[model samples]
Target: AVLTKGVTPINFKPEFADADAAEGEDTDPHAFQSVANAKIYVKNIADAFCTADAEGCDTYKANAAVYTEKLDALEGDVRTAIQSVPQEKRVVITSHDAFGYFEKAYGLTFLAPEGVSTESEPSAADVAKLVSQVKQDKAAAVFVENIVNARLIEQIASETGVKVGGTLYSDALSQPDGPASSYIDLMHNNIAQIKGAILGS
Candidate 1:
């Protein structure tokens, strides 16, 4: 409808669907994983909106550009913080798998007992295997995600004698007043936590 109407409409995640419901539907979308991805989303939204609504095209483009600049700055800060950790000590274990983008962007190695998504838990045997790997690798730290229960990570920490590094913002953004309200803030908070844990800050 946007293309035909020449006006952009906002899309909200299913998690945010309640907010949409207050307005009306339930949805559980989890597309935005990082600030970089958010920036791309913003650009795409703006372009689509502009193409649909010529009257507000300039405004959309300008706002996207401004927001994208902030995302770039946030990326720089994350890079700087992650770089503070020694490359050899950059390996980290998390309770669930959600750091592929983070690992690719920053120079960290991630190990997870759970598969790529956090929807399911790993088996006891799988956890035991990962525990052994953690010990063999001497991973700098083990982390839990805000969205996942920490019991599994705690057990792994106990078995491996590695302290729980800190919470990593995985599937969702924190509340607006929290440390990870935005995608950039999320990455910055995560990198800072990882560095502090691994580097003894």
Candidate 2:
């Protein structure tokens, strides 16, 4: 693998590469900052390919432009969908913090028991704190990620008396036959699940 071979790891987007970045303060280095960063990441990859083959790079760039346009449209659609929901009603509960970037890019508030990874169990203290927060905030919904166990979220929902919302895609794409097979499908599915759960509850 290029990574194991010691190939330079470039930041897909600089904003997502810095450590000092904060949530609402500016773009966080570890999280997706905005939908526009999608274009920058694609363009950076295209530029990387050019280092080896200039001819192939041109084709990559052209294709990237087309895809970037599609991303633009997707961003607009997301904004429109989110605009329909009231601000205070945008709270959601999940088990991990992987959606920080999504919350930053979009306008939703995501509360989680674990930070960034699903490989470990969340501490009892963290779970207790989140449970308290959920009860106090009246979080609109609790959702399980495709890559995470549903037990934690289900527990939260039961304890808080909030319903379990639909599953969201994170960490990877869903199977082709599933609801979030493509990037666009993932975005649409997440927003729909969010809005449906919040509004319906």
Candidate 3:
């Protein structure tokens, strides 16, 4: 009998979060996972720049517009890439709840052991619970995250028999030479890896 102690996190939510989820009680702070929200980040930054340096307002707006266009293209690309996988196979497993916004944006389902904040490690009970969920849901792939240790995910994958599809960039970007060096590249790499894993590529 596994002790469920230390299993339930403050940020834990039901696995099947609603489309407009108040998931994690509407407190998952990784809003940048969604490109649409990311555009808002750019706009806010541009607005701050314009306020700080009125003379550079035009330049700030122009730069924000350019980045926003790039984000638009990236959103479209993400949609197209994810379209290849059938909806039923869209379930994915990752290390934590960081991908909730991503799931909310891309029509994917993400299951994780930890909540949005990864300050603590998931216990054995959490892994066991997640393992059971993986089997029950027939989750397509499991991924390690760039910001957290992969040991927990590895244990979950081993027990559930789900392949460790690839590393997903969440909470941070990779080094300059890494595949996920930028926001656009990060989305592309994540979707490509997800698609490849689910489609058996």
Displacement of residue 83 (Cα, Å) in model 1 is 1.1
List where candidate 2 sits over 4 angstroms from the true fold: 1-34, 114-131
Using alpha carbons, what is the TM-score of model 2? Answer: 0.73
In candidate 3, the residue pairs with backbone N, CA or C atoms under 3 Å apart (3 or more residues apart, or in different chains) clash, namely none
**Highest TM-score scorer:** 3
User: Where does candidate 1 stray beyond 4 Å?
Assistant: 1-35, 114-128
Relative to the true structure, how large is the alpha-carbon lDDT of every model?
A: 0.70, 0.68, 0.76
- Which of the predicted structures, 1 or 2, would earn the higher lDDT when compared with the native? 1
Backbone clashes (count) for model 3:
0
For every candidate structure, what is the RMSD over all alpha carbons to the true structure, in angstroms?
8.0, 7.1, 9.2
Rank by TM-score, descending? 3, 1, 2
lDDT per residue for candidate 1 within 1-201, as digits (tens), equals 222232222244332233235544332223344456667677878888888899999999999999889988887888788778888898888754466556655678877643222344657786787688788877989898897777777777888877677778877889999999977778778888888888877
Q: Could you give candidate 2's per-residue lDDT for residues 33-81 as a string of tens digits?
A: 2466555676777777777788788798898889889989989988887
Q: Provide the lowest-lDDT 10-residue window in model 3.
A: 1-10
Write one digit per residue (lDDT tens) for candidate 3, span 42-79: 88888888888999999999999999999999999899
